[model samples]
Target chain A: MSGLVVERATPLCQLQDAGRFGVRHLGVTQGGALDWVAMGWANWLLGNPLGAPVVEVALGGLRLVCQRDACLALAGADLQARLDDQPLAPWRHFAVRRGQVLDFIGPRLGARTYLAAPGGFLAPAVLGSCATVVREGLGGLAGGGRPLQAGDTLDWRGAAPVAREMPAALRPDLAAPARLDLVVGAQIGGFDSRSLFDAFNADWTLDTRGDRMGVRLQGPVLDYRGEGLVSEGIPPGAVQVPPDGQPFVLLNDRQTIGGYPRLGALTLLAQARLAQCVPGERLRLRARDADSAQREHRRYLERWRQV
Target chain B: MNPRIEVVAMDALMLRLFDRIEEDNLPWLLAARQRIVEAFGAALLDLVPSYTTLMLHYDVTRLDLAEARRRLAAALDGLRVPEDDGGARHTLPVWYDPRVGPELTRLAERGGLEPADVIRLHSERDYRVFALGFAPGFAFMGLVDPRLAAPRLDTPRQRVAAGSVGIAERQTAAYPLVSPGGWNLIGRTPARLFDRQRDGYSLLRPGDRVRFEAIDHATFLRLGGDDTPLAPTGRAAA
Candidate 1:
């Protein structure tokens, strides 16, 4: 195991890989880091596997002390982090000597942050993943769904150099406003043209009710005229409009089945962008077909293998 | 002739199980499941069979979806839900009294039957376990006597305790865990339907047949049954 001890960690922090998969029929939702792009880049900076585990920090305000000298990489949102009062930024690599305190006061940009160690964190894989799902009581260090509480120590078995920097081209841009590309679901037509127009043209505000399950978008009331549809398999990025006429884009932790009339799933690439938006963030929708959505999804997946 | 097959995306292909569920469609549903499992190995991420369709989730990164559809079409072109594999019939026990079953009175009235009559009619039907979804161990069983068919609550409860036995439309189900739900809760089952520690996480799977056996409070307490006995296991597919 690498020489590193966590003197302090917070509940909002936990080890995450890409996600847990292949068990949705068992009703298990895929749980992983929200900002998948950042998670990949953090791992890439350390020359580790693209899916290596990392600490997913949400809304910052986390502190950890390196008991043994260790090197680490930080990526994703710039959470205004510091090393024992020495200021540090994200999308770069850094190190802390023994007894040095690493603190993430808060996010400077995006809502979530990713911190990567050399070989990923040491945690047991529950059902083929270490991503934590507090609702399901699965994944994480204890292998029972729970977040990293203060005083918890995260340990990893792999080690690398003190620090390394990711190239400018490799870092993700957090300044760009989130624009989600949606593949107008087949039911898009079932919705009156008026609803469709608002779906793509109007800017929606991210509702605070959002969680891993789904994000409720506050915008023009979306209407889909149809007899209530039968319950069917729900996919990630599914934009379901409940009776209230609001659209909710289901995310990684969403249930496997639903019955509400769905506008359709947002492309996978759009899902990644949606993952980072903070509450009240303005989002514009762009319509595309399956062929175009698939192409963009393919291009996004190719980024990890490009290394 | 095969029903229309559509490509939802690169990783998912939709197999119209049927336009609507009917007696004849069960055979097609079962056979298609086996064919997909045999044909698609690592490429198949999930096989989601719903009321009238099968959504196959695959790895778009590794294999193209059109190819998957072709392969799946070839296997399930002409199939049906096979004869039951001679599985044992599980008789679950339940108590459907008003104190224990808050929704019993409403459901009984809707069915035009007394509470006991509704309970007896519900327990008589041997319902096939459709596919499990919504939540872990949440079993979506079938159309109770049509007379018992009820609409889902207009307002969903903030939290439906685990093992709550509920009926909605023609379907009856048990909630394995506490979550917001709209099902018309008729009773509560103390029997753990989904205990992660138990060897069987879910007792019902898709295609399994289940029957409920009505029991009085005395027997219910002896069996440690809550208002409804919802000892669900993950091993079975419903």
Candidate 2:
């Protein structure tokens, strides 16, 4: 089958599914879509499973041309997509004619966007996932862990969408700032009295030191009065306080285990919202219990299933 | 037996098990694992198991932490571990040639013995698989001889080829993949510890015993030493 060629690509673009699992004990981190909500909507436009394969483009600069007629969906950040000089919007499905051009520029709001075809993008699964992790040298197109580069082609086999369209209102309005939710972490109380006050009240700027692995929050270096403890299993969203006092919140590509005093993990939904924010964006940390967070999360997903 | 279940987080339960892995709790821990796994039959997340800890993570919306922990505790209380710990003593044949054991001479000097004496001492000591991390099927074996104990290399190599055995901080192990590591190279076994296509991927597990034997490089490359451990082991053509 004809495939989508990478007329222009960047180091950040790669094929991803939900992620590889059951291998953390082996020290393998789960590498998947950073913004899952956008990934799911892109797949939904093509009637694919929520976790179906999709093209994740970070910081834009991606361009593709349809060798043959194709139906596709674009979601997440609006990169000012255009088809042959015609403007295109996000969170909607669109059909391109043979030899048509689909180009992406800078993000108007979010940092990443997802492109999905009818069935899903095709790629070799390494360790049960096509997700890529360059640091670990695992997952990719051939499953040997290579990221997409210019002149590469991506293919799929599912039938094309019967129609093309996404809700106009649903178009991601990321121009407005994003607010992330947080569920209080396990070691939150171990923090010094002053740090706790600053944690919830003060605004922390997102540091430039960011990647799929984690993002360092530049703010008041939190101090822990608790005894020096041994390192433990770290979870995604864990706000770890290094000896230097900086707090780094581990993310999707984090190591299986870590040795640091952790403030706690952010809830899954919280991580999703954070995925949309760019470096330098200001964020405030808040606390929520597990029960209430779970309920809110369940309600959020229920609406997803109804569609 | 239930591991003093605690709510370390909202959607995940922390099972703080006692150390040393008592016989009675092993079964309970295994059972709790089974139940939690079964609960997320369709939406399985990560089920991370450690030496004395097991953490079950799931979609918060699907299963709340309180309910998951309650179910896990019940399973632990009612479960039973098989009488035997699934393990075996492994005697691995490794080639001690300088080309393979790059640091053998250094180890010999450090231990105040001839190169051959160092090999004999290494081949005699029994080791235990204390944990598996750093890579897939990579076993962190413990109790390397005190004379051979050393801190890891100051600068880690970009790639430590798989099957390469090394020592670091009283721990001995083989690299499951070609990854950057700091362990001091001692020798390499032609045996494959991790093969995805194999039935049980990892050859060694926690609580397993390991011993090293001396062999030549020729035997290391040949004898079907590669992964996919299915060939019948015959003593020799003789």
Error of model 1, residue B65, in angstroms: 3.3
Distance from true location, Cα of A237 in model 2, Å = 2.5
Task: Report how far residue A59 has shifted in candidate 1, in Å.
Answer: 1.7
TM-score, model 1 to reference = 0.89
Tell me the tens digit of each residue's lDDT in model 1 across B122-193: 889898777678777777888688888888877677666676778988899988887777887666666677
> In model 2, how large is the Cα lDDT of residue A245?
79
Residue A137 in model 1: shift from native, Å?
2.4
On a 0 to 1 TM-score scale, where does candidate 2 land against the true structure? 0.86
Put down candidate 1 lDDT per residue, A1-307, tens digits, no spaces.
3344555566667778888877766667777887778887787777777788888987787788787777788887778889988888887777779788888887678877888887888888877899988788778888887878765678776766434556687666768988888766556667888988899899999999987788999999987787667677786678899999999988877887778887777777778788778888899988877766676678876776664
Interface RMSD of 2: 2.8
Q: Candidate 1: fnat, from 0 to 1?
A: 0.36
| TM-score on alpha carbons, each prediction | 0.89, 0.86
Return the TM-score for chain B, candidate 2. 0.74
